[model samples]
Target: MRVKKDTSISLFYDMVELMERLRGKDGCPWDKEQNHVTLKPYLVEETYEVIDAIDSGIPDKLKEELADLFLQIIFHCQIAREKKEFDINDVMKLCLDKMMRRHPHVFGDSTASTSEEVVQQWEAIKKQEKGYEERKSAVDGLPKHLPALQKAQKVQKKAAKVGFDWKDINDVIAKVEEEMEEVKEAIAKKETKDMEEEIGDLLFSVVNLSRFLQFDTENILHKTIYKFVDRFKKIEKELASCGKDIEQCSIEELDALWNKVKMNARKNI
Candidate 1:
């Protein structure tokens, strides 16, 4: 199913008008009092809800959550317009201009027969646009706020594009084993900082291996975490039925219960 598309630019303006009305005299007390700083958390929350809807594969919920996200955007734009800074129109124009500049194969004589060539051309054009001096690092374009695994994957992909990567998956696997050995040594020595560093290196190498194998490290980790949560909750409910708390349970008992739940889950799957 398709969402009711915001087909006209006027829709954005209308949303802005609504935000202004809500913030006007005798309007919503909560909306009237919110500023960009105050609304930041809601923006982040709405974004995650949109991501959740997409992950759950619910088109109707996705559309609703997306509209909430757009509302946040419009709210922010309305606030900025009041300060004479920028508005939704400026945001739209900037995006349009950036896309036009980035797609040389579409708007210019440049042609790329493959996605890899397109990426290389895009990076080259980006560097030319920024004049190189502004970006001192090859991975500088990556967002710092990205989840750690995704950020690591992005950094590795960027470096690989510039030929600064392992020759094969075997090399990455070897590096991971080396990092694991360091982690084990650090653990044996009870060196907390060293152990942490080595563990991070191991995880980063795993992300690199996932990239080489054409797997999404983020999705893999997310699914694993979800499974752990589900199985743990089942164990919790089972223990509750037995009138035994987790803290009071022996390690062996907990282990047995966990394995039972896991095996049952796998059988169902």
Candidate 2:
């Protein structure tokens, strides 16, 4: 029988059943051919689409993107079920059990008075659950493929929890400056590998500074890129107003136009 879309639970089961039908022998050849490896890209794509939708600040778009992401989860669960590994129910059960285990302050007798304490307790519990004694390092659990900025932040955070962080934000700032100087030295020596390594160190220090300041480095860079693109388009429009284009302008002329755009942007702000 077809499940009615009257409730969220029913809708979820409907999605699961739909995936099952799609992977059946008489169903989609493309869908049937897909395995966990083949679907990895789609999983990543849908997750980023959901992030983009949230960034767009559109409720309907976010809702649609969330559904798409959820579909990827259900599809993966269906594949696992086909292989007799696990299904959606098992997935949900494991997550629920883990949550209940992790949140001892909420679900058990443990007490966590502050959000910071709660976070610390959660990490402690997670480390214990993962057998901290057997792990080689605190950084062992970090995924290798995480984005560089995020990975740097995570590695720093993990180390910080174990008292490996700088005692002062000023120290982090000094490290950034030291890295910048090394980068300049590498450039003067014309060493490609040294320059690359110094640049990475500079960025890593900057990531630490951002975290110390309670900021997100990736989101900060994303906003900066958006601002640059927006201002560049305005520069293009202003140049066209004078019957000139960016390519037709001299370097000084282009710089003057860029200044005018920046002034206009500040005025609007």
What TM-score does prediction 1 earn? Answer: 0.88
**In candidate 2, residue 103 scores what lDDT?**
93
Estimate candidate 1's RMSD in Å: 2.5
List the candidate 2 regions with Cα displacement exceeding 4 Å.
Answer: 1-6, 130-134
lDDT of 1 by residue, 1-269 (tens): 56456655567667778888987887799987788999988988998899889999999999999999999988898888888999888999988988988888999888988998988888787787745667888777777668788899999988988799888788889988999999999999999999999999889888988999989999898899999999999999999998889999999999999999989998998
lDDT of 2 by residue, 25-71 (tens): 88899999999999989988998899899999999999999999998
CA error at residue 217 for candidate 1, angstroms: 2.1
Give each model a TM-score: 0.88, 0.94
How far is 179's C-alpha from truth in model 2 (Å)? 0.9
